[model samples]
Target: MYDRLHHFYQHALALDNTPAPDKLTLHFPNDRPRKLVLDKSKLSQAEIALLNTLFHTNVAVHHQVTQENEWLYEWLINGHSPPKHKLERLTPPPLRCIHFSIKGELNEIDAFIEAIKNVFPSVTNLLWKSRTEGVLLQHLPEDTVEEELSVESIIDTLATDFLIQTSFFIGSPIDSSHLLYERFKWETTLYDAVKMTFRKKSFFYEQEIVTYYLLHHIPESTLKLVSTMLDSVMNDRELIHSIKTYLECNMNTSLAAKKMYVHRNTLQYRVDKFIEKTAIDIKQFANAAAVYLLILRLEAK
Candidate 1:
């Protein structure tokens, strides 16, 4: 079944200049058709026969496809009704279909319907139209104008549906290529979402915006810790200037003291006070690494 569906999609994509169909309309020739259509009323008996012939199993069948002359409707209706004359009028009578595989499960049907719904909200609409459109009728007259579905419209709708679903599941706005790349990793998916988002508004060089939002997801406690460290040494502007100079000089305290026009001993005194207030020993490179990174982030913003 998966292979069959894949082939159908591949064929659809292969169409070049040919106009795309409005809906998935399969035409079964008078020769060999791969599907069976069942009457809603005689479904039970048809299901039993199908199971016996195909699987030699006596399992109950809960699903069947109703054959309209031109289209097949997978039925979810209940017990049989009498065969109406209208059903016979269909060029090709509907055949009842049944499967008795032990692996057959309701979840498969649910998944299929869910996927189909995403691509075509008009599935039920088509079914409703089938009731009035009649089976095996001639194609609409070329001069008879009607609204037609286009490949572009269908593709756009599917793309929008995917973005909505992805955003809802990811719980974020998903506005950047980097975030999208990390999450979905599909180039096409990322391209479509980014294009759609850009269409609604202009996106400037977004590196700064991406960094800001990335930081927003960081833990509050971690941000608070960084904030507290910066605040502790904020009052001593001279000491702060000395420390910044020292870092700028690649941690050469003598060079920093010379640049600040201060004695080395006085610079050392301020460094000690900074350590005491922040409880961060700058002499140990590992402890100073996080502070340096935070400073870079702050400066970037």
Candidate 2:
């Protein structure tokens, strides 16, 4: 497919009568030089469109006949010459490209390709590499679906979906040798790797996983402190409710007391005791709020 596309591009160039000019050069913002020649004029409008879509801007076509094929080599080694400016400044933001290889009947392949094109008009590169092989289509700025939901919820959905897809293929007592010990560990590792590769370039969305290793690895004493705090206030539903209400009210003792239909002094004493018992200072606001929320989340689960 790649070879056919290359051939087609060259043929298109030839057909355009723009037969690879001699010594054509392009100066980027960084004063970097990129030199290349169209071996032929076989490029299609779709291919050109794909390139434009990926770059987010039109690229000045250059044809160099005299110079050796040193443009790619120099650009890679010299780091986009001139060194002062950046290539990104001259070009558009990075884009993602999704490549598809279709085979089988020509009519069927053409229909499929057309369907994709209709949905993704920005996709420009479509090449019928061979009659029997099929077409190769490249779509820039990969598709992404966004929804209003929590990250954890998103991860859970993904995990569930994955299990459903693989469920039919596996028998009882599925193989686990290749799997990581903790599901969250696998999730985090996959998240980091995917983010590194496709997070910015592609529009496709994925969940960001948070590890609970910090909590799990904490000292036993610290764990005990958290447990003790939960147990002590576990039965004190009224106090817990009041404290939550007060915190949610921005730690305004007067407002919280009024909301709870209690005297300001009474609210103050409860708040003070909450701080003392949990070793979390409610006066500091931020830290107190974090602990308060953490407890609430844990309790809800």
lDDT of each: 0.38, 0.39
For 138-213, candidate 1 gives per-residue lDDT tens digits of: 1222344535334345434434544321111111223332232123222222222332333322221122234333
Q: Mind giving the per-residue lDDT tens digits that candidate 2 earns over 207-252? A: 2112122223345566555656566666888878888888878889
Model 1 Cα RMSD, 1 decimal: 23.4
lDDT of 2 at 258: 93
Residues forming the 10-long window of minimal summed lDDT in candidate 1: 93-102
Runs of candidate 2 exceeding 4 Å displacement? 1-225
| Candidates' RMSD to native | 23.4, 21.0
Give the residue spans of candidate 1 off by over 4 A: 1-221, 298-301
Model 1 accuracy (lDDT, Cα): 0.38
Could you tell me the lDDT of residue 79 within candidate 2? Answer: 17
**Which candidate has the top score in lDDT?**
2
